[model samples]
Structure formats: structure tokens, C-alpha cells
Target: MNRYFRLCIFFFFAVITALPSQTSASWQPEITIGLSQGLSGVHLSSTSGVLYVYEDLESKPILELPQGSELNVRILRDQIMANGQEIKGDQLIIQPGADGFIRVNHAPYRGYITLLKRKGLTVVNHVLVEDYLCGVVPKEMPPSWSAEALRAQSVAARTFALKNRKRHASEGFDLCSTSHCQVYEGMSAEMWTTTEAVNRTHGEVLFYKGEVIDALFHTDSGGMTESSENVWGSSVPYLCAVIESQMQTQPWERSVSLDALMQKMEKSGKPLGTLKEIRLSPLSIGKGSGDRSLSGRVRSVLFIGTTGSVVLSGNDLRSIFSLPSTLFDIRFRGGEVIFSGYGSGHGLGLSQWGAKELAEKGKNYKDILLHYYSGVTLEKLY
Candidate 1:
């Protein structure tokens, strides 16, 4: 062998050895999803679609256990397993399933479950809350929640699940908890609408380092959510708006003549309307962009569904806002952002309306996640 060639081979191996080993296709099969759903069944979000079922434990009903049974079992933290599915972990992250709530471990965080006695069975129902709306699922979840926030959550869940289906895997879901991504919990079938949103936005995709990542999701925390990447520092999406449409259309909106407004330009020849109003709009107003106010002779247009206010500057007839790459049905008006943005979550990654669409579509929880988020995969952690 040539001495030079041997040296090159050694150098090549050294570089290869220094690189991180890529993860191969995972072969872990699912064991079981654990949650405390009774005959009423539980719900789990999946790429195939929304699934519902129930399962109960053969062990003592936490509530009805004969006095002595209570002694055998203890309420450690506020959690209990359901459907007789044995779980060995600090906690189980359950998806409401067709047989019952499916159990999987993401991470033991916060929230509580209900335990009571009815007849001979010990009733256990885990009220899992994978903080979909607020910031990282806090241990003490706020009692009062915004219906709109929940809707964003449904969209996130569906988008996440749907992308996994495209990956063509059979058993496992992407971890839906922790800061690495958003959190999820299947406490009831009522959230089926949430899953429907997932299926509707199917086949959507995204890439990291050009490799497909299971899109993690979350509900609206104001107009902010997690971002895929930043300065390589944060692990969440920053506050931004997902534009849905263009062409501002409204009989009333059209009634106000832009040409006429331009005709009213100042004698100095400067455009009269310079984003004339500093008014406010609904946080996520799909109602014609937002509220329009009169600032002197100028028109101040307020936008809905954003974290904070941004001023987009242009020569004329333009609206600017920051977004990832794709432009989904968002309407932008031309001007400079005068206000600051607040909170982080998907303004449009999962629209509140989108969540309602999920529910109306008859999609289960899993189905909802698969719809909105694109390009990614799902895995289950036991």
C-alpha cells in the first residue's frame, strides 16, 4: 500500500471516530399505555386517527378499597394506574385510548388524578395535564383556562401525531412532554376535536439538519410557542404569528377607500396615513385581520393572533411580520411594528379555529396532532 494512502486512511478514520454516532431505526415495541379510564374508555392521539377505549385495574379501587386494602395501596403524589396495566416508573404519561387511556412515560411532571370507590371496583381516573396552553406544564396548573388556548393545544397535538404516521411506524409516539417539546394528556374523550385538527393538516413536514424531526407541539401561550432552532440556545419556538391569508376583504373594509385615503395625502406630498392608529385587536382575531381604528386622518390597523405587536414598514400598501418559511392563510398589512411581542407558542401552527375543526371532523385526540405540524415522527418512551 502507498505510504501516503495509508496516512490518508488513518486521517479519515480519525475524523470518523471523532464524529457522533447516528441513531439507527429504533426497534422498541410498545408494552402498554397506562391511565385510569374505566369502562367509559380513554382517548389517545395517533397518526392513524383518534382512538378511544377504556381499561380498569383488577387491583383495589383506590376509593372503595376495604379499609385494609387502603393500607396496601398509598396515594404517592397524585397519580394511580388504570386498566390493570402494570407500569414501572415514577409516573405514566397516558393517552386516552380505545380500550382505556393509554399509558407511556414522558416524564413525571405535575397535575393530579381522581381516585374513588363506586361498588366493588376501585375507581382511578388520571387527570393528566401535559401543559398544552401555559408554559412548560407547571405542577400547579391554573384552574381557569382560556378556551382559545386549549384550541391551540388541539392543533399542536394533531400536527405532532400526523407527521409520525407519515414516517410509517406502527408502535410508539414522540414524547409529548418536557421542554424538548410540548406536553399532552388524555383525560377525556371530549378532546377528540383536538385530534381532528391533526388529521386535517396531514403530510405537512419540517426538517432539522435536514433530518426529519417529530414536530413537537403546544397550545397558545399568548401568541408564542416553541421554535425549532435559535442561536442554538433555547429549546422552544419564539413568539411569532403564522399568517393565514392575504387580500384584506370586507364590504366595510372596502368601503374605506385606500385610493381615497391616498387622495387625502398631506399637501406636503407625504402619505397621510402612516399606520395612523395604535389600536388593539383580538389576540387571535381571524375576523378580518383585526380592529381598524382612525388615528387622525390615518388608519391604524390592529392584528389579531400574535404574541406582541410588530410594525412592518413599507413604501405603500404592505404588511410585514416574521414567520418560519411557509405562508399559511395569514393576512398581513403594510406598516412598521410599533409594539413588542409577548408569550411564545404557535399563533397559527395550531389555530383556535383549527382545533374546532379537529373536533368537528370527528377526529380523536391523536388525529388532531397529525394535522397541523408537518415533517416529523413519533416515539413512545416507557
Candidate 2:
């Protein structure tokens, strides 16, 4: 009997090894996004069919509402109340029927809606990663852009979402729906073009040395991108700076009065009373100098004032003055400090405008991605 059992086990192993490897369709991972937080109450409705409400971890539906039915959820002390009735649990999951979508405060969203009472009522969306991207790509980039550009944006967004999946874990979700995470407007933001891009690049991600990359992106890169070390003070091999050969410089200018600057400094807890002079190196593109990054972005600035002088980083200045970018020249004129800069964002990773230019020049999405993210491989995770 032992010999027969061993033979059966050997045969089972052989059959298993002989079968082809495949990722199951159901293996698609879901991402939870914090839609709203600290809400006293929220309204929900079904868009197409019935909506099933379930308590956390329960398969059976606790409440069901037909089409057009509305439910009001609120928090009282530590309890969850729905439609004037107190729910037994602190969390409630709302799932839609076939081809149905749930609307939270009139904004329709794909996948299940979860309401959790943490401090106050929090609304979350539990959506498949791909479905989430459909809402993201359009908001991050114009849906009217080239197909390849859209496709590239899709991959980058997906990789970014996956890499930062636990960014808001302590806040009870994977990410937020604002620009702090990725601007996600749910079903309302989905477009046919951008959705196609997400579908075409489904399960695709940018990987560096077997791991997914952060895949940071921005609005424009001016003429050159900055190294990760220069921007975030950490060296990432795959995030090395690259020059956009076909791209032209995008220049911007802003001015702030010295008095305004002093007030801003005081508000920021760094009281620089009566600004006397601004000392910064002249702006030079694609080269690093003292107080400047390799991409010519201001790394630090020496702010001289009458009361006391304090040196501030370029990012701090950007926040204080609402400047477009850190790559700028500071000049004192009359009662105002003029800031003339290039680019629009942090000047790291993929530049959206640069991608559009490349796509218009006949480069595919892969080419665009490779040009921005050095030494990375595109892999289909699913």
C-alpha cells in the first residue's frame, strides 16, 4: 500500500510539472484608495442595479437596495449609522450588482465602496489596480494626447501606485484620490482613449534590477532631467539624469516683494526681518555649480536680511514664493525679487510634455519610457 501511494504521488508531481505556467485572471490585486476622510455623513446610491451592503469579513449581504435607491451613512460616537439605523459594525462594504457602479456623494466609482469609522467616517474605494489606473491616467495626462504617450503614462502610473501601495496604510488605505497620491476622479474621469491606454498596458510596470521603480513623473523637464540624488538626496541608479534632445526650454518668471518675502519667512517660522540682498549662483542648464544641482536647479540659497540671515533650500523657496520650479535665477530689482526659471515641476523622471513631443516624433511608449527611466525593464506583472 505504501509503494502504491508513492507511485500516485510521483504521477501527480509529474502532471503538475508538465502543465504550462499561467497567472490566473482572478489574481489581479486590488488597491484601496481613501476617497474622503473625516466626513460626518455621506450619501450613496446605485447607478445601474441593486447595491449589496456587507459588514467587514462577511460574505452574506446585510442590506440590499434596488436601482436608484439612496442610503445615507453617518457616524455617531464609534458606531456606523445607515439611514437612521445603527449598524452593528464599524465598517461597511457596499458592492454593486452586475454592470452596476456605486455613487458616493454622486460621484460614481468602480468596484466596492467601503465606509470605515476611524476618528471620523472615512470613505474608501476598493478597486482593481487596472480599474484604478483608468481613473488616473486621464487626470494625470490629457486623454487627447497621443496613444503612445497615454500608454506610457499608464505604465508609469501603475508602477508608481504599486511601489507606493502602502504609503497610506496607517491612514486605512493604500492611497488618496488627490494630487498627493494621484488625482483619481473615479468613473467620471475615465475616457475611451485613456481607458484603452490602461487596458493595453494592463499589468505592465517598470522594473529596475528585479524590483518595481518609483516611476516619478512631472509636467515638464525644461531641457534636462535631474538625478534622483540631486532632488531627493538619495542616489537611485535607474533615476540618473537624462537630457531631452528634442525638447526646448520652458521658461517661467515670478516676482515677490522683499517685504512679502520677509512676511513669508516669518510665517514659515524662519523670521528674516527686512531682506537686504539675495545671493544665488547664476542659472546654468545641465551643469552643477555651487548652490546648484546638476540640472542647474538651485540646491540652496543664502538669504541675507537685516535682523538675521538664514539659508534656505530651493524647495523651501519654491513653497514660500509659489515658484514654478527650482531651476531659476534670483535677481533683486527695486522692491521685488525676480525669479526667472525653466521647467514646471521637480524636473525628475518622465516629463509629460517631453513624452508628448517624443510621441509626436514617432517614438513608441516603450521608447519614451526607456528614454526617461534609464536601465529599466518593462515587465507584465500579471
Candidate 3:
């Protein structure tokens, strides 16, 4: 009986080993990020594990420092220098500590980091794609939200990161930790719920025609979402208008003087001498008419000024006024521009609030993604 049981166990192990593993080394690629720029120096420290610094692309590390060692890096005469030693290479790679975190200029980050002297400063914080996403998920969405919602968010964020990987190529980094790219807070913003969400949907991304789509998202969609052509001047097949019943009504009211409005426009490079009259053409919540998008979001508005009347898109007006969204009504009354609007953000792709509501109502992450991004397939890239 014992011999038969051993034979069965051996066969089971052999079969398992023959099958392919999803998370192979080649699938998980390391992602480079420029954490901080325009810095002539950086101070790093690791307490738990030995920090290895590589000055070249060689297999062996040049400096294997002890734990809790504080190292300072600087640039001198257009050459990289570390700890007062003239390093040969233009970059230095610092491996993460045994605790899986490294301190860069007092802030902790997961995975390895590379320091490079570029232009007038040092570029810091290069990390793996998964480690970077762990910091991004919690900062982008509430960690306490439904698991399904967070999981959807994880996939969307991952897709966005991969799609825009070369956004900052000229700046010597793939992406920045700001709204321009994706808000990454590093180890300081790590949350267990968000981390689990990222792990649950690891390497999963939304793809259209075998290419990763720009998985844009926003806070709310008011009543309807807009197509990509109307909002961003590109007609994307998957980013079509759709009504979101789960989203609540969000109204925003603001008042600004005509002088202030003119000043704002001037700062935006559109110098209108003086404001005369503001006309707003109204459209239905789900229908576009005249200068509005298919979802009734403003596409363009005519601004009557003393010098000359200039036409601007609703998105442009939103930026000048710091409004939440382009869906708004404007009226010039008593020398003040009274504006009232609904929803928030660009109203382009997935609605984060809509996802939360759907998750609460028993919808899974996959369902939420399909509802927002139509005609797209969820693929496991790594």
C-alpha cells in the first residue's frame, strides 16, 4: 500500500511540473520610473538587508555595503559620484533590502532603484511593474472600497501604465508620480486591501484588437459618458457614450466675476480683452445638439469679448475655470459668471463611483470593466 501511494505521488508531481506556469520570469518585466528629478544629490539607507550597488551592467555588484549603511550620491563635473567615490558609470543601481523596501531621500519605496545623473539633477526610483502598482492602487482609489471595484481599478491602472510606458522618454523616465501619469505614493501609501486587489488581477489588462487600450477613468459620469472623439478628438470604438444608472446626481455651483474670468483666459493664452456676453446652448442629458458632444457634454462655446469673440471647447472652459467637468451651464448675471455643473472629471472611460455602486449591487470586477469599456477583452499579459 505504501509503495502504491508513493508511485501515485511521484506521478502527480511530474504532471504538475510539466504544465506551464502563468507567472514566469520572462512575463514579469521590470518597470523603470523617475521618482524625483532635478536633484543633484540623494541620500539612501537600508536597515534590514545588505544594499548592493552596481556601477556597471556587469553581473557582479561593485559595492556590497552592510545593512543600515547611509550612502550619498551626487554628480560632479557631469560625472556620477557616490559616497565621495568617483563611480565609473553614469548610473547606480541599488537593490532593495531584505525587507523589500529602500529609503530614498527619507521616503521608503519597494523594489530596486537606479540613480542617474541627467541634465542638472539625479533621477531616482526604478521599480518593478507590480511593486509600482501596489503603491498606485491605494492612492488612486479608496482601499476600503468593495473588492470587485478595487480589482477592476487594478486592471485599469495596470493597462494605463503599460500603454503609456514611453510617455516620459525624453525626461529620462517612463512615468512620473503625478496626475500627468499616475499618482504613485510608494511605500507610504501601501494598503493591504489595495495590494490584494492588485494581486488578484495581476497582469490582467483591457485589450482591443490585440493592443492595450488607454484605460481612462474618472470620479463620476453624471448620467451619461462621452465618446472619445467628442472629448479627446479621437473616436475610439470602445469609448462610446453609455448611460450609468448607478451613479448619483452630483451638482456643482460656482460664481466668478467677469474680470476674474478674463484674467483666467489670458493666463491660458487666449487673451479676450473684455467679457461682454456668455451664451450657453442647452442639450438633453443623453443627446448632443449644436456644439455639444453625443452625451450632451459641451464640445465648444462662443465667448463674446470686447476685442473679438472667440470660440473655445467646453473642455477648454473647464480648465480655465477649474470646473469639475464640461457638463455645465453658464450665465452672466450682475457682473458674475454663475456656473452650475454635474458630475466630475473628463467623463471619458470607466466611472469609479459607478464601479463602486455596481460592486455593492453584486457585480464583479469583470462585469464593471466590460460595462465601461465596450468590445474589449480582458487579457493576462504577464
Candidate 4:
């Protein structure tokens, strides 16, 4: 096996075997994520404990650093050193203080940290997976929502984290602290409600055929959830279309000037010179009438312009116009193109608003998850 693959395998085994079982007891799995990049230097501190600095994952420490002593790290061509000492070898490991936080650039992260130079910057935050979820839950979904909705979001986020653990493996980390993975604000974003949700659903994940499924979610679904085939072209049985609620008409509208629309079209490489007219396939309120997805989202559109006409997919239109979703109708009126639509995000997986509505009407998080995800079982994996 290659050196990197061996190292990853070792790491995975270390994490998995470190725990007695997937459930029954809590396992503090280390999740390394890229926090920021292009940073020339970083400042770190811990409140208590004998902070040990190590070269990579070596047994011997380079320095048994003291607590509360701020270490300002600077990156050289390859090595990152503090106190004019060559501390970085392979990677730099900074163990956190006991029951305390590791302060990075003054912001505190609730675990030990590993610093590696990448693209001329330090990258890596070795945090406990549960602690990482604490940072992610609130930012991904509101803490004030119904308890069941928050719990549903917690399970979804946890499943997504574990399933996509190697999403940024080439970057020397598991995930990124942004929407690219999950919006992990670390410590500051944690709230009581979200924390409770995470604890209650500890180690729980959505499973399909005994493996963790991609528990994708969004802000709202308008009234109906979208199928994975319609959005990403790969259909997961659990991500099929469903009417989220009986009450429809969650309206959202946006208007852009003809010039703005043309500029966007030009930027997208499909320059329709002077705008002539936009022809949309007929659409209905719920069921897609013409050239629309089963959930009523636009499938394709024809842009007729003075220079040339271009046909674009609904996704392309959404991207160029900055529309909330593909489920929209285009109307040209008085030198402006107005897009009227429902929904906030891609409309796949569990909808936060839909979950809230269901929770309010006596649905638990498991029920909400099953309703949105089709056939799936919730399994507790410590």
C-alpha cells in the first residue's frame, strides 16, 4: 500500500478501535477539518494542562509546552516553526489543555489541533466529531425551531459528516468549515437547543441498506421536496419527490433588469446579445405542466435574443439569475425579468421548514426524516 493510504488506514482503525463499540458508549472520534488557508502565521493558546507539541504523530514530543503560553507559528517554505525552532516535521500536533479549549487565532476550538502547511498556509483542526457537530448544527439550522426539527437536522448533519469524511482528503483534512461541507462556526455558534439535539441523537445516523446514506438537507422545500435525479441526475430511492405539506404557496419573487440579465448570461458564456424574448414551457401550480420536473420545477428554458437564441437548463437559469430554486416562472415586464418561485435551496432531502411544520403537527424527528427520505432506518452508531 502507498504511504498516504497506509497512514489513512491506520488513522481510521485508530479512531474506530479506540471506541468499544459504535453504540453503547460515547466515542470521541477525531475529525480533521480545514479551517482556513493562505495564513502566514497562527496564534494558539490553552488554559490548562501540560500542552505537548509533537512532530507529526510521533511518540516523543518536540516540546512539552506550558499552558496559557501563546505560541505564534510562522510558516517557512516547508516547515512551520515557533520560537525559531523547527517544530513542524510531516505535521505539527498541538494537544489541548484538560477540559479547556485550544485557542486558534484567538478563536477557541474545543479539541487538539494539527497544523500542516498547504499552499503556503497552515491547515487542519483535529476536533472531536461530536464537538464539531456542536459547531455545525445551529449554523445549518436555526436553534429556535421545533425540537424535532433540530433533532432531524442533527441526525442529517451527522450522517453527512461521516459519509463525506474524506471529501477533502487531497487537502490533508476530512472536511472544510463551510457550506462546502457544513457551516461549522466552532464554539461561538453553539446553542443550548442545538446542543441538546446533538446529545439526544448522539451517534445516530440515517441508514440505507445498512450503510449511512447522504442525509442532504435544505432551508425549505416550498411545498414539495425534489428528487435527487431531477437535481443532481443521480437518483437515490430515499431522495424521491414528495409533497412536504398540504398547504402550498410559499411565495418568493425576484426581479432583475434586462441589462443585468444579459450581463449574467454573457458571464455564463451564453451571450444572448440584445434580449428579444424569453419563452418558458407552460407550468402549473403543483404538477409540472411542460418541461418541468415532477415537482413543478422548471426543466429547461429558451432565451431568444437579438444576437442569438440559447436554450438553458432550469439549473443554469437559476445560477445565472441567482434565483432561490429551479421551481420558478419567468415573466418579462417593462424591461425587467421577474422570477416567481417557491423554496430556498435545491429542495432535496429533509426540508427544515417542512420538518418544523410536521413537528408542530405532532410528528417526531424520526417521522419527519422517514417522510422526506422515503424508505430509511435510523440507526444509532456510537
Worst 10 residues of 2 by lDDT: 16-25
| Candidate 2, lDDT over the whole model | 0.85
Q: State which candidate, 1 or 3, has the greater lDDT.
A: 3
lDDT of 2 by residue, 226-301 (tens): 8988778899988887888643478888988877878889988888778877789887787788899878888999
lDDT of 2 at 138: 98
Candidate 3 lDDT over 181-284, as tens digits, reads 88997888999999999999987888887667899988888778889988778889988888887433587888999888888888877787988876668756
lDDT of 3: 0.79
Report lDDT per candidate. Answer: 0.29, 0.85, 0.79, 0.79
Residues 1-382, model 1: lDDT tens digits: 4434533553453344221111111221111111222222222232222222212232322222121111122223333334454323322222222222222222221222222222211222232122222222221122233333343353344334323421311212223233333333333222333333223423233433333344444333232222333112244332122332222111011122334433433332434444244344433322223221110011234322223433321112222223221112223245323223222233334433344444455654344444444433332210
User: How many clashes show up in model 3?
Assistant: 0
TM-score each candidate: 0.27, 0.91, 0.88, 0.90
Cα error of candidate 2 at position 270, Å: 3.5
Name the top lDDT candidate: 2
User: Which runs of model 2 end up more than 4 angstroms from their true locations?
Assistant: 1-25, 57-59, 246-248
Sliding window of 10 residues with minimal summed lDDT for model 1: 23-32
